[model samples]
Target: MGEVNRRRFLERMTALTATAVATPATLGAIANAGSRFPGETRAGSRAAAGRPDELKLPPAGRPQPAELTELTLAEAARLLRDGDVGAVELVEAYLARIGRWDARYQAFNTVVSRDALEAARTADRTRGRAPLTGVPLAIKDNYFTAGVRTTANSFIFEDFVPDFDATSWARLRDAGAILLGKTQMGPLATTAASTPTGERTTANAWAPHHDDVSPGGSSSGSATAVAARMAASSTGTQTGGSITNPSNAQGLTGIKPTMGRVSLHGILPLTYTRDHPGPLARDAVDAALMLQIMAGPDPADPRSLGLPPVPDYLGAVREDAGALTHPERGGAVRIGVLPGFLDEPEPPEDPAPDPDPDIDRIGSSFPRRERTQAAYRREVATVEARRRMLATLEEMGAEIVALDFPTHWEALTSFNFNNVRLPERSEIFLEHLRDDVRKFGVSLAPWINGLLLPAAEYVRGSRARLVLLREVLDEVFARCDLVTQTAPFPFDMVGLPLIGFPIGFETGSTGYPRPIGGMFGAEPYAEHHLLAVIAAYQRATDWHLRRPADPGELRPAEGNGGGPRGGAGGSAGRDRSPGRYDLFDVMERGE
Candidate 1:
């Protein structure tokens, strides 16, 4: 074992006796018993015990509708701008909701009730400078929030607080956005748990009672917080599918901005090449509003394009850029589509009666299913939804461009996370890990402590990825304003900006509800075009407005006994095909 790995094992030996490996049955039992994890309980179920916040749900000290928490950020923004609601009342409404329902969802790691109230009060007395003024928002725990405990949902830095804000947070603060609290995140912003340190398991809002489903990760809590309406919007960082995957599971609209569009200063790194801090919200316009407020260049982070002047993203959305005449096509858009994106692969011709040959040989009852039939129902729905969306675009004069860049699915799975990305992550984080040990308040999450690789392999892999993605993206982008595709995409490898939102949901024989979303991509700086297309669709559709089943309402519903991957586990991979031509494929074929 490496030096760091040895020390981590030694430090964890004493605590090992107190913890047990979680199994499906134990997890379900723990959730059904009302405490999903230790030190946590459902909404309004507090008692005389741990922290004061755990004691009871407090009143907001103001009059507000219970449904105010359910309002979209766009709706709330209109009221705030039109003088229908004051910043303080809006803040109180959100606080009351958090105090009431957030316990069940367990979306936040820390609730800054007092600080949020003060900020809202200031917005009422001062002149606002930006679009999201007085709009309450949740900060991801990984982002640096001065004076607040910005633990990255990891035990290593449970008490660590930064003296400065990430550029994204600083910009939001300057815009008069109220900070509700730091929402939970994947451990060290790299795993599914917000805090797997002791016994804190942040449950998904869609299926709180069962272990069969997930809200998605590593930005698991951010998407859930917004989907469950605990916050108007929340920031989520994506290295792979962290933003979009959770959005798909929770039925929320999420944006993974082009890399470096939002400065990463003070935020923990997952992959320096792929990490993007973006917003998860109600719809495209709301996401556009956040982009306008949070994006821009910061000299501190050299990766930031420092684009001379940021565009008026909100204004552009309103301008209906998707409807604008393509100079070449004249009042039409060219949209790119990959037909196989969302479809289930056809079974092989003349298939054997027993497809599960391995299972039969091993004497098992059945072959392991990777995903649920309920999820496939949504996938089929998504495929149909994309076709309808395309028809609408064509009706409005969009020319469909069939695309054949088949390498993406391979890129998603084969590229770095725990493999190629680990060495670079370790180089950047080891010092912090050592410091984390000295200033520790909780246990170290295993992945961060155990995974290490040589820097040579990491660098070599990263370069190849950049080259392949850049070429493929250029080939497809040249023919379209925005490229639309289905889930399980590999867009993150090249840091492409994508807007992910649910197309539809369905229930299968299992009786569990499944949600599926689609991705809209544009080359790096073309976020505006992508937003325009999405905004145009959103204006004509209500998909983004759909909400998931409330966590508080999750009961013992009948579900099929098969264990579906359920889009949890933070897994991303491309489908295997002989057709795609990646650099790896070329090396193998000697082309």
Candidate 2:
């Protein structure tokens, strides 16, 4: 798309998402429709809660030209610390890249060019206290940035700027990380929506003609930016599958730290118990680098359980891929697998398979035109990815064991218990908006206007959630180190640490190949174990590094402004770099 089209696309997205149902007639009618449900007290709950279009801040201060966009966050840090690259140079590389490419991808919300460059300049003067200090990163709109407008991708607070930073963000900011911009996201973190505005026609990073797919949200832009290499790393928040889904779709590793592992203060609320603020990065190590800074105590947030002793996540996820050598990968901790899951699809085994998207959801085209053998192949390919992962684990000497599927998965999946908490959320919104509640995002009106629920239902759902969190975990972890699953939402429901990583890619109608990811869940607070397994698998695989072929290989759009994809004239295609993908193959042959 050309510059004008790009500009229009962004403008339209902002207008649509900011389209609030704040008409006086609508507000008055919704207000009068009060308490529709048995226990919901919209006014009483005056409490609750709260991306797709990425808006770029106007360009400002000069950037230092440096050929350093694709370096892993760790590699970039090493260069920064060794004085091989100045912070300003690295910052310019990213800003220059974002300027050229983001229009094609629409992955960011607000690009803080002026502030980011200034921060980079400052980092250049100071000695680093952390590895993440000199990196450029993006934050989802849900996290507050003092003085920056954090709309949460809603019309409600589109004009609302915060005077404080969310704890997770504060830590990163203090660490010397530069904020490239906020990412585009779903309205109120609700769905997987597109970019904030422009680049509507950019082909899938995998295929050009076929671009129809959920970029995945509510962390859509964060994933896209990182995958597209717009930023070194970005922040993603997950109340349900936000972090993992986007990570899976974009071929990135997203770690949803255990609840309370990271602080929540100064951020919008989704569910009191389920909200998770974490990092999305190109690899597990980059993710670990970010988590090291985010996973600690916050005096501001009571929920920030203050990690008693911070673990060296970076040390755990290393290039050495040594986690596979740990005896726990074999004898000490059992690899949890549901009986017969790997064997065949027989009905009797009764399993709580992790969160895999519905097959219909994975299908690419619209309408029941036809189901060719090609479609069937795509489905089979996804399943095969899972089997390959199982085989790899066995090769590494891990002991796979059968465990009864947890009962909670059924209810947790079928009926999101978090639904009962809706009234509370709406209440919080109204409270936050106060007189301006009507002035808030009007799109929310359809969901909350006159909405109420039976207090008893809310209570029952909360109670059921408690029971599931307590009882199911006690049983599952007693028998295994972590459970294998599709999406890991069951774990999210009860506030457990869960992760999802790409195993391979699957071809579909959208011309672009879809990512095939496997999900894993650890007992609560066992993120280290989760990270270890991810690090090992990634060290042995190349799928995560594979970038799509047609759409993005450093070529700027036909008639756009940005110079090239990486500025250094580099192609992101991992397939071209034989050594990278061959790492695991070489190891396999030697063994």
Candidate 3:
């Protein structure tokens, strides 16, 4: 490890040790119980100590009414401007909701109750109801906050409170957004795992009630909190799939801004090159409002230099609705559909029921029969859904054309490799691994080394990947005004806007939980235009507003279990194929 990374790792280890010591015995007892707040009782059941079913349910009743729910940032701003609501009331409402639901969902690590209320009061008093003034927002734990513990979900930094706010945090505060608390994030934001150190793994709001299922990584808590309405919206940082994937799972709208659009200074680094901080909210309008307050160049972050001015993102939403028509309106809306992205070779059948006694013993609990039938049904349903979505878009006046990029497959490889070199991972291992390496086991040593070595390789190859991605993106742009595919898989599952660049296959590798989808983007500062297109689609259709029925209300029909396919594990890739598109036909046409 490099000298700098070695130092960082050591610091983190020291922090982790401190955290271990500081945690009360009671905390450790309940840590695995998946309860975040202490002294809170399970909502519907008596505590059974170690039983998972005894965990609390967040306070009930949708905090935001359907009419008030999914309010765009612009609309909220206008309300604040018009004195429709007070900042204090809004902050109080969100806090009350958090107080009730946060324990069950384990979404936040810290609640800045005093700080948030004070900030809201200041906004109401001074800003006199500006757009974001008094808006309650959650900061991802990685961001620095003065006088608050910014642990980055690592034990090593448990007591290491920063003396300064991250540039982004400071900006949000300045914009009059109240900081509710620090939301949990994956440990060091390295692995895609949802469970970060010191916090429970967040569960998908749409998934059956269980903690083991994937909540879509790194930004898991942020997405979950927003989905469950613990907070109106929250901040998340993405290095690859972090933001978008969680947003997909939680059914929230998220933006992965082009690199350099948001400042990273004061925020913990992952891959400095790839890490992007963005908003996860209920819909596109809310996301746009948050983006307006957060986007800008920061002198503290050298990467943000030479960036152009951020346009009024809210204006783009208006433009999409024909509120601001320009000469470009006469141009046909040409959208490219990359059909090759939908194809995936089936996994070789599970080694024919491993006949060995040992294999049988290990797999005894596996529900083979029911899981198989459920998987088959889900595959059929997913295929039909995608077909309907595409048909619906075409029916809505979108001119769809086949837009193929055979090289798009390279993105998955590139992103996987890029993840290793992230500074956060390297720094953690470099500083902390020497003494603890033996304790973590031989397997982890190689994995840590894999992270380090491949990170070096990724940095070396990034230039090439960027060149290839830019070339492919340019080609698509040349042929059509926009490129559309099944918006990221999680978006449909969670029900949010699909407005970003596509970077991975919609059908993920075998054994993985969910299929991934890529997004489209324009030049650096041009994300606004891309967002506008998404907003246009949303305006033309109510798809983004469709919320799944509450899990408690769902009932199974006569022959079927109303439970999610794959139970929790099976749900991962059960819906891989688009319900609408036929893989065989797309492949045959390509051939």
Candidate 4:
């Protein structure tokens, strides 16, 4: 077969693999709708509550135990294993914290109190066993969990529940991990903007500074929950930038394991070619541990290729610490700095406003020149940051070499198009436009429906674009151990780890809704190990340790200069039921 045919064949295989991996719940919804679901439709329960504007901020009070909340997943596991804390106690602590805070922040859509307690009970039964036994976790709503309402933050699947656990969820559960319930996610896990605009726009735990800004989509809830200490760790998925972006925005550590590192079975799909499942946590060690459990092949998922014997991520974490401490052992690590990736070109000085034919057709005009200038300024900032980051690494005794990939700029746009075009527009047509347009006169019907034709065309265009981008990336990765670039601004400002934030500095004003970052991936499987390295760096550094400015507060004592008469010692009343309940239940008549 010719190269084009070969690529087409591979793409088709990937799409088939994706279709095969989706759970029956998701496939059933698609069959009923006559089209695949959009990210918006599968959105978690939080999105079902309302749009972003309707979300009310959680009431402010004294800061909750941010430090305790920020413990790494591994540390939490050790504490549980050592009897320093019981599973039930840990669950209750987080439950109380969520009650005290999540409403304002909208970090979770559903809290499985019964399931959590049962899991905790199971953990207690298995006391003194299982590395992660009894440890609480939050799964992004996109992952399938049997009998749980796994909404993708969309109305289409608002009532859909899966009958089986996603591969990673099953592994974690088997490992004695307790599920705290499904966290919120972007509407269908589409654009990064979805992260901040879902049913309950998840506020950056490090917000006001990071809130208001996009929380990084698709995995927003997962990142926010981990950051806010709602869960010791959480699972997140990425098609383009979901996991890493939210991780960056929330100042947590995230890994986007290479395409097949973890089974994609039982998750909602954006694109089959790029979808990956990984972990988001307070630090690298926790992420690594989760990755170890989640990694490995599954016969159920055709795309699951056997990973070369999985290493002890905790061991890798230890190795990273040793590498940092022993410069002689680390020996001038060669980091390739992608300068072209850094020097994002500003659009022309006198660019036409509303240059896009689509925008012009809509009679909307954008400030083209101002947008160009803004792009230039943002690129300048990105380059400067890249330089500083290199300096920081060099100060730590690493060698930095400048590398260039002129084609990298095109890669981001290409990836973005592929990420959204087909799935997004397909749902928009079927859900919103088709029926309405079909009601028009027969003669006008075709013309009106023609507007929806772009969706299919865009999908085809995206396939071509992906081919080009993938080829370019493959070439760039051939010579570099790792290509380093500034972590995106939205994430950098919040002090999140960048190990996997993509390169480039596209401006939101320049039609990109978020600050794009550079990436370092070589060959098809390079992102896998590169991300591991990024996790390792974070494991060795304090960069991901930064906390939010106002992590919200704990409700004060009633008698001591506080509102409403309550108990002292911050002990919010506890119900000893085997089942867990939130403040909402306490406030409401329901138990």
Q: What is each predicted model's overall lDDT from 0 to 1? A: 0.60, 0.61, 0.51, 0.52
Error of 4 at 215 (Å): 1.4
Off by over 4 Å in 1: 1-64, 127-129, 198-200, 306-308, 319-331, 345-369, 406-413, 416-418, 432-452, 486-489, 509-513, 549-554, 560-591
Q: Write the per-residue lDDT of candidate 1 for residues 285-340, one digit (tens) a residue.
A: 67776776677777778887544355445544653244444533465668888667
Pairs that clash in candidate 1: 409-574, 413-573, 510-560
Q: Candidates sorted by lDDT, descending order?
A: 2, 1, 4, 3
Q: How do all the candidates rank in terms of TM-score, highest first? A: 1, 2, 3, 4
Candidate 3 has its poorest 10 consecutive residues by lDDT at 582-591
Top-scoring candidate (lDDT): 2
lDDT of 4: 0.52
On the 0 to 100 scale, the lDDT of residue 423 in model 4 is 46
TM-score for each candidate, following the candidate numbering: 0.75, 0.73, 0.68, 0.65
Better of 1 and 2 by TM-score: 1
lDDT of 3 at 305: 72
For residues 230-332, write the lDDT of model 2, one tens digit per residue: 7888988887588887887777889898888888888787657778888988777677767767877667766664444554454455444356554244553
Alpha-carbon error at 103 in model 1, in Å? 1.7
Q: Which regions of candidate 4 are displaced past 4 Å?
A: 1-67, 192-200, 208-211, 306-312, 320-332, 340-384, 406-474, 485-498, 501-523, 526-528, 549-591
